[model samples]
Target: MNELSLPTSTEAAIRRVEELGEALKQNFPEYVFPVEHSLHGGMYARTIRMPAGTAAVGTLIRVPTLLIVSGHVRINSGDRVYELQGYHVLEGEINRKQMAWALEDTEITMIFATQAKTVDEAEREFTVEFEQLQNRKKEISA
Candidate 1:
């Protein structure tokens, strides 16, 4: 069997998130609310809480973000799925799309770094349109 490798590009991540969000909505409709807040250091964190057996999907801005899991969750990102329990933190350059399946009553938080002054501004900076990200990616690659 081939290992599922995470997509290396932000464009692929954005596409993956959309696909997963659709599937999750059809299969687990109850766990889709995300509450976001701005923190110091131009950072923002979005939290999603769900009951056991429910799942949720989230998309990220192009910035590197932190993942904080409280309780138990099975996270599926890129081409891989993994489980975490209790309180844990993972930091990395995540794809634009991410999803979590609740193994227990779980709360997952995504922390983003941004310079925006308000929650709305932070959200706008964090969730830039896919087309813009794609264009920026192209410019960077070129």
Candidate 2:
């Protein structure tokens, strides 16, 4: 209805999304969507490769980030469900959790403008619970 609904209730939406993510993790095998990181010219890009039909959930974004969606996917998000295709690029101030199913093999990249010199620094800059969940993800997925 309204374009990019800003989560009817931020906390409620967050809890709902996180609950779904946890349930998916508990019910299904861990689907490892390989993540690639690169830093260049005052910017950082985190690219995730997701297989078709697989689902994923993302953390809260701490800042304005650039989201580039390649291939086809349906993101049933906290605010709305976005069916995106091709190489769509948008700068978003995303503030909640994500639940996405890849319609086709997909590449989703989050680019950030950063002065940080290392990937670790850039991640800490953008992520809310870098030490808690993000690091744990790297460990589990590695």
Candidate 3:
């Protein structure tokens, strides 16, 4: 399978990432991840910045999203693993939870198709995932 098309929503994948996330929390300092949001036309984009050595575990995305990862990182997506750098984009992925470690300061952005006018509305639309990340820095629309 290609980078964009991966086996998702498998129970094993979500569990493995959850374990990684817990390990990261215990090993690293508390980080309030910063996110930037943008909305235009029918798309909503959310960008997150992860400093080197920090890791993040994502919630299952309810909608198909375009993922752009910039900088160096290792991503464990259940049964597969990837080490990516310098602006790579993965698309057509839905219902997946991912675990990523930033080898360098990294930025990950996910774009979704939506009619939401504000960040609040977008969260409301995709409540399942965003609720899991509510502890992060306040959502800032760009």
Best by lDDT: 3
Per-model clash counts, in order, read: 1, 0, 0
Predictions: Cα RMSD each = 9.0, 3.2, 3.3
Residues 31-98, candidate 2: write the lDDT tens digits.
76778889999889998988998888777777667778899998755567889889877656656556
Candidate 3 lDDT (Cα, whole model)?
0.77
Looking at candidate 3, what is the lDDT of residue 127? Answer: 45
Q: CA lDDT of 39 in candidate 3?
A: 95
Candidate 3 — which pairs collide?
none
Write the residue-wise lDDT of candidate 3 on 19-54 in tens digits: 877887788776778878899999999888999988
Candidate 2: stretches off by over 4 Å: 1-9, 132-142
Question: How well does candidate 2 score on lDDT at residue 83?
Answer: 91
Candidate 1 local distance difference test against the native: 0.63
In model 1, which residue pairs have backbone atoms overlapping below 3 Å? 42-114
Candidate 1 weakest ten by summed lDDT: 1-10
Candidate number with the higher TM-score (1 or 3): 3
TM-score of each: 0.69, 0.84, 0.84
lDDT of 1 by residue, 1-142 (tens): 1132223335665577678777765775443344545478767776766788876655454666677789988876566677778987776464356667788888867687777777657656666653333323444668
Model 2 RMSD, rounded to 1 decimal:
3.2
Q: Among all windows of ten consecutive residues in candidate 2, which has the lowest summed lDDT?
A: 1-10
